[model samples]
Target: MDLKRRMQECDEFFRLPELAHLVPQRRRAALEQLEQTGGYLQTAEEILIGAKLAWRNHARCVGRKHWRSLKLLDARRVRSARDLAEVCWQHLQMATNGGAIQSMITVGPPRQPDGREFHIINSQLIRYAGYRNGDGTVIGDAANIRLTEFATELGWRGAGTPFDILPLLISTPDEPIQWFDIPPELAREVELEHPEFDWFAELGLRWHALPAVSNMNLEVGGMTYPLAPFNGWYLGAEIGARNLSDTNRYNMLPLIAEMMCLDTGSERNLWRDQALVELNRAVLYSFRRAGVYIVDHHTVAKQFCDHVKREEAEGRACPTDWTWINPPISSGLTPTFHRYYDPPDLDIRPNFVRRDFSGDGGI
Candidate 1:
């Protein structure tokens, strides 16, 4: 279906009986008030309807019978306007699931504490932020750093790993920052440097990281902050890279998968799987630190599926693994280094010695 027809279908879907309950009456009332106060009523209607359908679909996918039951939109528990906005976000997620799009752009705060390590991760996040489309066209404009500097000046501490940065870069309270483009080599360097940075290594990756960054950025009221070389190289890389000749590779799906492999181990055991999972967790942490959502694997898979669908519709041969374009480290781009030292495992018990001071008591 065409974009307009699909949108119309989406609109009609919201009016369906099963989905109508998902729309909050208060939201409708608020929109009406805004419209009376000169808000664009038609636009508001489209937004509200879209939000309702999105929430309904999301809830349904998760086997939820009502929108109120979902943590994202429970009115009784919703605390802020941001939380309310997530009700609309459910639509983006649903769209991805339905193969309508490969990715939905979002902006937020870094997932790591505001420190050197966070800055490194932020740098990598900046690199990925440059990811673009085919035909040498940019995706979003370059991410704005002035707002980030402003937030830092006002003392906003960020959280999460690199991937989370996208949201923050895109969603600063001021004007929207355009997405920038980065060269592949520079992107690699940023990834390598991220883990080597200190601030990130100190706090250690934890489950609560992303949420913490998001909460802190929100609390600080969108002030700009001072980001180190992370922001600089990111911007430089975006300016330096040429657009990919092939449109299929533009998604950078393989790059993400490759990074995932790098962060994990190869042993054929639970430890290996666990390590890989940690890598995934770390990536999410990094993205959160960068002030963006870590679009889950399920979302990425859906995107890949969408690409396949599009290729089929266009009567072109769809490559099964565009990820191979970047090539894996094992394929020889990285140099091998042997360990200089291997420490032996040892177990020791502590013993206490009593000191004798017979003459000291008398003194």
Candidate 2:
């Protein structure tokens, strides 16, 4: 987009009563630089506010109620792929926070005038490697097949397990892609077990505690921080209902159904539905047992409602995507499923945008 125009829009946003606490001079200086050189650097305060606003403006997120609590780390001064990878590891350590899971975003160096920038290849900081067998079976999270193949091409190898964590891949303009293994301690995972069913633990299911997304670009003011990885605590359904249960991913429903001795011969039996509920219960039970912070879909939907009300009280509309705001399971039972919201606008600045991973070695 036009850099000058976005800066002007951002300048006006800061002038609003809610953001008046931020010094106006920084924006003036940025505007002056843009006018003279056709580019400008965002000050730390601008970056922080922009990141927070971006989260607030993100339509797909149901966790926007905690936008102000996001911790912003300006890593623009980082000079190499290795340094960037190290910062990412540190981000993991900090965000994990011994299972309390702090909300955070790390803004890397902004794109140059010609659009060259660093980017993390992984969609999320932590994801299981998906190994496709010749028999058309996947050993891990099938959703990550592309990334897993890319990592293999880069000489990174996995232990060939259903829950093997993939290495981090960082790409810079002029450097070869670099990969880093997340320190084992920082790759915290919760082993899933049902409180009522002891046999559930035999499934050997687990999931990472953090959900830091690394592949999305952070568009703030006029600059695009391509390596801005951010995360929030996960809603239980994301892991339980979608990740573990989705057919395209681990596809655990059939196995769970068989183990429970449920009649899955027909769709009318609702075996999949019963298995889904038990899997969700196991996820919630396990996280709580492990002392890792997690929220249920019902609770998050209520929080989303509160967020919408707060945004309305400020005389601003809360742009929302009904499809994403609603949970995958029992969506109709939640408050978010019953109401219409302001239509989402893609042009909103200070927002996160999915990065294109269509290039060679890309995910």
Candidate 3:
């Protein structure tokens, strides 16, 4: 993007109506530099606003009800690989907040004028390794095989479990990509167990406490931050319906059906649906009993509808991607499914943009 357009986006974010009360006064020199050279978020208030705006403008996310409450941690001073790893570890702990997850993002240094950017190769802060067998069967999470291979190429050692957090792979301009092991305590996870099914605990399914997506490039005006890892509390369906039940991921629906004694002999039995209910039940039950923050699809869908109403009241279009607004399981049941959403912004500013991970194509 051109520098002038980027500066205007930064200015618009600074002047957003939701943050009207909290907006800080800008300095004369900074304002001059913003117009002439380029804009950069200077104050804590500006940083916070930028991060919040990014979340609010994320068209594909249905969890933007807490966008205004995102905690911004400025880690722009983290220059070395060690410091970057430490900052990420700290971010995990802070976001987890002992089961009461906090909506948070840690901002790394912005993109340089020459287009150099810092990036983490892992898709999420925590994910499992997938080892594919000869006959196209995966031993672990099938969705993670490509990333697992990447980590293995980087000399990472997995624990050979259903769930394993990937190591941090950070790359910058001058330095070759460096991999760092995530601190054990930082990646807190919960073992899946059902309230009714005794065999559920025996399956030994586990998932990370927070889904901190680490790869997206965060743009705040003209400066694009390449290593901003951000997270929201998980939705029950994301864990149960998609992650565990999907064929390309854990592919546990068939196992779950067999365990439940559901008729999976034919497609007419609706076996997948029955199994999904149990899986979702286990996830919701486990998170509640473990005192972790998790939202069910029905409740969050209603909350998202309310968010849309509020945004409409404020004369702001609730731009949303319907495919994402609808949950993986029971698409017809959620409130978000019935209604049409406003078209998303073509160029959403102060947002996280996709980045190229392999062979240094700058964002």
Candidate 4:
């Protein structure tokens, strides 16, 4: 969350040889732009809003398809990490053609976050820097087709059943850049290694020359559940990219991750404990590449929950009723205490209470 500190770390990290020489001025410019653009945290916050929308959409679709089953929808469409990287690369290329230089943003630990860290890069400014060959034949188109072929060959699938290809299709190259091409050796490898390459070869389409650009937002969340305190903590990160090119293209891929520590103190009630368990499992199943850490809830939640009890216990005031109850409820003889409990409020019970983590209203 400390934007300035993280930016400084990023500045130092990018100074390494592999990444440093690639874009020295651009890197400095990005750092300066990050400062002038209101720092990493602020920019990340804005991107989070968009990522949430994307996450919600993905969640809804997955829920609709397999909410009944405990098993999550498989993301075979996004199967390999390489597939994601390629999509990101195309998106960056698209942004470049739009006359906007791309900026990379990272957040979390001095190294990497335990949960998820969202990233957003400018896609409109970085130019495609045209792909060329030693022989002078354009290679951008060849590269694009090869990327898609590689993805197909990998049998990649996104999260969910029958994994919606829409995200990938939209995220893939969107424009036709005559200059962007792939190398012959790489193209040959695709043809040799992937059986699907036969289809491309038969179609007479240079499988390696297909253009790709991705302009999609990503939202990933991670959480940990503790049994003792009977509560859960969550961390979320998100990023959005817009492909400016007609063919989906990206120059670089952003790597993201997150971590969460859960408190489980007030878990006396079996139902509450069950809720916490389900919540944790759900989050794990939903987000890949997320790390979770658990803590004793009783130690943490004791500081938060007023009362913790098992279902058998009676005379225990519902925590929600007390927390939000505007006027003290009074029995008719006393004053009519129960009437103040809104119908909705009466229906809803606090099975679990959070302790350690906080952000965006516990979505």
TM-score of each: 0.24, 0.96, 0.93, 0.17
C-alpha RMSD by candidate, in order: 23.7, 1.5, 2.4, 23.3
Question: Which has the better lDDT: candidate 1, or candidate 4?
Answer: 1
Q: Ten-residue segment with the worst summed lDDT in candidate 3?
A: 22-31
The residue pairs that clash in candidate 2, if any, are none
Q: How would you encode candidate 4's per-residue C-alpha lDDT over 47-146 as one tens digit per residue?
A: 2322222222221111111111111111223423334334344433432223222212111111123333121111211112223346844433322333
Better candidate number, 2 or 3, judged by TM-score: 2
Ten-residue stretch with the least lDDT total in model 1:
344-353
Q: Is candidate 2 or candidate 4 better by lDDT?
A: 2
Off by over 4 Å in 3: 18-41, 358-363
- Model 2 residue 324 distance off true place after TM-score fit, in angstroms: 0.0
Where model 1 places Cα greater than 4 Å from the true spot, the runs are 1-11, 18-46, 58-66, 69-203, 206-266, 274-363
Q: Distance from true position, residue 2, model 1, in Å? A: 4.4
Indicate the TM-score of model 4: 0.17
TM-score: which is higher, 2 or 4? Answer: 2
In TM-score terms, candidate 1 sits at: 0.24
Tell me, by TM-score, which candidate is best: 2
Winning model by lDDT: 2
Please provide, for model 2 over 1-363, each residue's C-alpha lDDT reduced to its tens digit, 9 standing for 90 to 100.
Answer: 677576676576566555677677866876677667666777787788888898999999999999999998779999798999889989999999999999999988888877678888888999999999999999999999988998998899999999989999888988988888888999999999999999999999999999999888898766788899999998999999999999999999999999999999999999999999999999999999999999999999999999999999988889899899999999999999999999998877768888887764445
CA lDDT for candidate 3:
0.82
